[model samples]
Target: MNCKLLSVLCVAASVHAASAFTIDYDIPAGNVIVDSIEGDVAKVRQDLRDTKNGWFYWAFRVKGAAGKTVKFVFTDKYGGGPVGVRGPVVSKDGGKTFAYPLDGKSKADGFTYTFGPDEDETLFYECHPYVLANWEAFVARHAADIAAGKMKVETLCKSRKGADVPRVRYGCLSGTPKYRFLVTCRHHCSESMASWVVEGIADAFMADDDLGKWLRENVELMCVPMMDFDGVQAGDQGKNRAPHDHNRDYTEFLYPETKALTEWVMGYAGGRLDAFLDVHCPWVRGQYNEFVYTPLKDPKVYPATEGFFSATIEKLQEGGLRYKASDDLGFGVSWNKGVTYEQGWSSSSWVVHNVKGLKTCRSFEIPFANANGAVVTPEKCRLFGHGVANALRVLMENSQPKL
Candidate 1:
């Protein structure tokens, strides 16, 4: 073939290949129920038609009065790629249009969004939107306490990019041991709310509090903040990658972060972990309260047991965080849908399988754009953190061996 003809054919093939990987958008049939407002997803489906990374997105419109901002919950269906629900994008006209992407920052392990005036508008994601450097700064700011032995910061493992995924732990105790707890956040790079929550828990543990004091004396705490460091830093969703999600990778011990975390839990807990809570934020719409999923098939998992799901729910309620119950939502769903559907392949399930002593293995799904009755914000996230910390205290309390 002539050189010119060959070049034309190559370009044509390239374009065809690019077109083959476009993002596909879809709208599922569901609605989000927030404590602040009733949110129904305008649509639930793949948001992109073509992308090289096999991207799939779901878009939902929150409907409310002119001045009323409503928050909607949307799931990423299944599959395991970078999944997201963009929000806080105001449409001055009801659903006629969207204003802008709720602005945010991408970091090594997650992103943080700045909710706009549309207090009702919000978005959640599974990709990085902030700078990892910011987290490093946070670590630096608190380095003194960590170095002084008041707090602990250790490198659990390094990522594919060679960045270290650090595990932070801090709590002071006084009484006899009762039960222990393990909390992990940001296994999916874009799930930032949990990152902030984890930080809040850290603050509570280090700061003066009766609960913190009690924890130190009676319970042990293990935490891994931001498990998908490389993906978070790169602004990649970090899910559905060639390898697997940081959460699901636990089964094969693939990713450095997941491997490190699994090893840490097994070794440190020594099969005595009382509970394991994997923190995360769900899509833009599901009436789903901050809920827990209990595998219906687990003989050892009695979701109806007095202290199992019931007990955990009670603690969450007391902490001021509302939640509901859901099915296991297993790995099978993940293969058929998008990232959000990648449920069972998580740290939550691993705890159930490996940690025989664990009483509860649950995942906390906070709404990305909105949670409860309103949109998500830093302040609200802080409150969420407090609730989570309180819940941890309660879980330990309930699990304690009688004096």
Candidate 2:
């Protein structure tokens, strides 16, 4: 071969090799802001705002660097912190499943992961995140249940950006249900684990167990899985967004989701809205943030809410990362102190006021990444969710109608 031709072939091979090291955020639930790259290190930022400044969303994928260490120093600008003690979430199988902390060498700013030669691409995130992709997977699994009156699906609203928000209803809505259950989740996009619990609730309640059978027969349960649909897609914080977020939209109804659900609850038929479960995740970690808790609500439903929690805690004793009754985040503590619905009304507060003859408007604060020492995984949360249904059914069965 001529020297020039040989050189040309070598250069082409080099270009092909380099292409394997690319990184991107173009897939579903992809959220990342790459600031710059130097050597084997990448400086990335979390884009936590749909419209305003925030720091609660982050996700990205990386290629190349196989068998070599790559450093990602993410800026902790607006409290979008690590998952548990680990640094971000890492997904090796194209984001289907994930493991936390990137398993990297920790740094003051970020962490480093030495990718295995077999690792093609791995996704990293602020926490263990569930995106539209996860929802799609769930939908596919339960499509039959949804279609056959075992479960019902409602479109909460078209988002400002045209995404369809889902309101999943199981059991009947008419005929004076003996008990009614309402579940709202993902008011904050960064709190991804909340939706998994919602899944557990619906899955368990629709199963063939006593709770599931009874739920289908006499109870009507509805869940708004992703209230801030656009925010979750855009990787926005969805918590404390300027003007208002979906959760904060409970009163004035600025967001389309807020408006639709506000009206739906107010106009509930037969006035049997017995239980309202607002699932959420607390800030990264701290004294009140580690375990699950229910922020204080109206004193009127305290007994009912307490009863529900006691029942739930009793049923959730299946080992890893479970919920406890002692973790109750009451008034003046956790997030209840001086929290204002000034922007509008928060979800729990709005439900207490809007749902006439409401039984218990309760909130569940799950951890974003870790609960106590146990890492909060989707499966565990789902199990906890199922167990919660057991409790709800027990509570319902034990109560009699008003005289």
Candidate 3:
């Protein structure tokens, strides 16, 4: 055999092996920005273009490296590394089913994984991403409810990129002015867990028992599953985007989604909104970020807010995820208290002051994982949501003012 021919074959084999692994980020909320790939290490970072402080929201697919071990190094400046004990979320079968790659590990900088050779593709995300598909599934699961008028899907408005912003409306249409309520989530697309918590609360509202029945008969539960639909679909890090995000788009009401909802609420709600809850997930795990609680605000609203918080905490009886009243962000003592948006006030705060007759308006910071010393699994996340919903039910049943 010619030595020259053998050398050529060796070079060709090496080329094929090197080109085998492919990384893709074309799906919804799929945002893995690969800086470079060298050997078994792929140096990556979160795709953040228009934000002051970049957030960790990445999703990408790895092919050909199924049987090989690889290290993914994230260069994003994270105040806290990947979520709680679970270092990062990975899906062997697309984004339909997700599991913590490093369960309760809390490892950071990057993670090393050796995929099953048989697996054709695997997805990796910063956290368990809940996107449009999950929303559709949750909606479909309650098909009977929609048909029976137990739930109605409303298109709030069209996003900048021509996507429909969906708001789920549940409870009584003839809701007494006192029982009207509104909830919003996913203003920051990276904050995916907030929407899951919302789902759990929605599940509770649609239950069949006395609490569910009463909620259906007497109260109105409206949910904006995702506010920045375009941002979410594009997988943009919307935290502190260039001009303003959905959360800060109030006051002047810049974005279309924010503007449309404002007009709708002004005309439709007419200041009779009993409660308004805006859902968000804070920084990575540890201390304040790992618990579910509302930010402390003016003492004037504390009585009602504290009352509702206490009731919700009480009803959260059995869930693995829990929220304690003591965990509430204090007015001046907490970090959230000092932060302010230069453009305008936040949705919840704006609603509390501008919307008349509004009893309670607050923002909930739900942990991405490792909340209350428990790993935030899909099942536990849903159960925790049920706890939120139960608490909402308790708040409405006994505290409404006479219509």
Candidate 4:
């Protein structure tokens, strides 16, 4: 064969192989933008969508590349691009579970994957994903309790996109409870780790253990599992969304979910909210972002906050993800300052300033991938939730009026 013909055939085969590989964001909580594919490298970026600035929340799946290796490159320039500390969490069995790619497969901006010979599909995300279906599975686990009226799941409200936002009520639902607490998570849609922690708290309330029984008999707990339901389901980077994200919408109440939650809590609390815990995940990776900590939003509530932190830290020592009181970010420290709220009031800020007789209101930041030196996982997050529940019991007991 002529040398020219041989060279032409080689180039044609390479083009066909590159064209055969495909990338998409069609799964639940999926987000990605594939720019182009050349040989074994695919240029892509997070679909920023309505996000006002660069944020690192993205998930996507690749197919038709079995037995081949591909290097995903984030072409857009964001603060740190879309890659995470532990690298892209990968799932081969259809998103049911995920794990960070083995060492040497990840870099500062992306990761490489060599799909198994028989593996037809794979999912990758900035972190382990907890979508609406995960929450539904959790609710299903308590089916008997839900049927018995021990737990209730109702729509918080219809999101702007017309999806039913879920609100869970459990513990002391019969008569007026001595203590009422509100726990919220997923104000930032991509902050899925918080949902796991919230599940742990709910599980604690439903369990037959001492803390659970105490909570069931004396406390009425309200939890909004996915505050930004639309963003969560749509795979949006809910942080710093245009106009403002759900957390920042507390003041203006632009979002339906936030408005509904605020009104419901106001009416339900009736001037006596024991505590308001807003669960969240910090940045992709960094010092404070890698630890479990709470922001001290209000200095006036420092004593109450200190007491709660002390109790939680002590309980944490029993078992669960490690969290230290020293990790708490005080007001005006780091990003917990006035500038952070220039966009609007966060849930913690609103609850502290508006909810009368509020004992203590604070936002808990659970790292997306790591807590201290321990790697964050669904089980660990739930265990942390249990610790939080135990601490709450102590906080409530200590707040009782003098005999």
The best candidate by TM-score is 4
- In candidate 4, what are the lDDT values of residues 303-378, reduced to their tens digit? 3555565555556543356788878887789878788888898887777766765556778888977678787888
Stretches of candidate 3 above 4 Å error? 1-19, 80-85, 104-106, 174-178, 301-303, 314-318, 400-403
**Model 2 C-alpha lDDT per residue in residues 173-278, reported as the tens digit of each score:** 4466767888988888778888888888888766867767778778888788888888777777777787767777776677888778876776754334777888
Ranking by TM-score: 4, 3, 2, 1
Instruction: Report the alpha-carbon TM-score of model 3 versus the true structure.
Output: 0.91
Clashing pairs in 4: none
- TM-score of each prediction: 0.61, 0.87, 0.91, 0.93
Q: In terms of TM-score, which candidate is stronger, 1 or 4?
A: 4
Query: Candidate 2 — worst ten consecutive residues by lDDT sum?
Result: 77-86
Write one digit per residue (lDDT tens) for candidate 3, span 1-403. 6999999999987996775687889766888778888888888877777877756667788888867888777777576444234677888886678888677444666778887878768888777888888889999999998888889998999888888899778877654534777888888878888887788778877788876787787778877888888877777778888787789878777788777777767877775677778889887756687777777776764335555655565555446676677777777775765367566667876676667655567788878877787777666767777776667666666564312
What does the lDDT come to for candidate 1?
0.52
Off by over 4 Å in 4: 1-19, 103-105, 301-303, 307-311, 317-319, 400-403
Comparing 3 with 4 on lDDT, the higher-scoring candidate is: 4
Show the colliding residue pairs in model 2. Answer: 87-101, 104-112
Candidate 1: RMSD to truth? 12.0
Please provide, for model 1 over 1-403, each residue's C-alpha lDDT reduced to its tens digit, 9 standing for 90 to 100.
Answer: 9999999999988865542311111112111212222231122333332222444322233322224322233333344322233333333343333333544432212223333455343333232233465466667867775765546777888777787777866664333356667788777665666676666666666555786676556665677777777655544444455655677776676778777777777786666576677777654344442232322323444222323444454446433344433333443343223344354366766666677665566666665554444445444555556655776666555563211
Write down the lDDT of every candidate, Cα atoms only. Answer: 0.52, 0.72, 0.75, 0.83
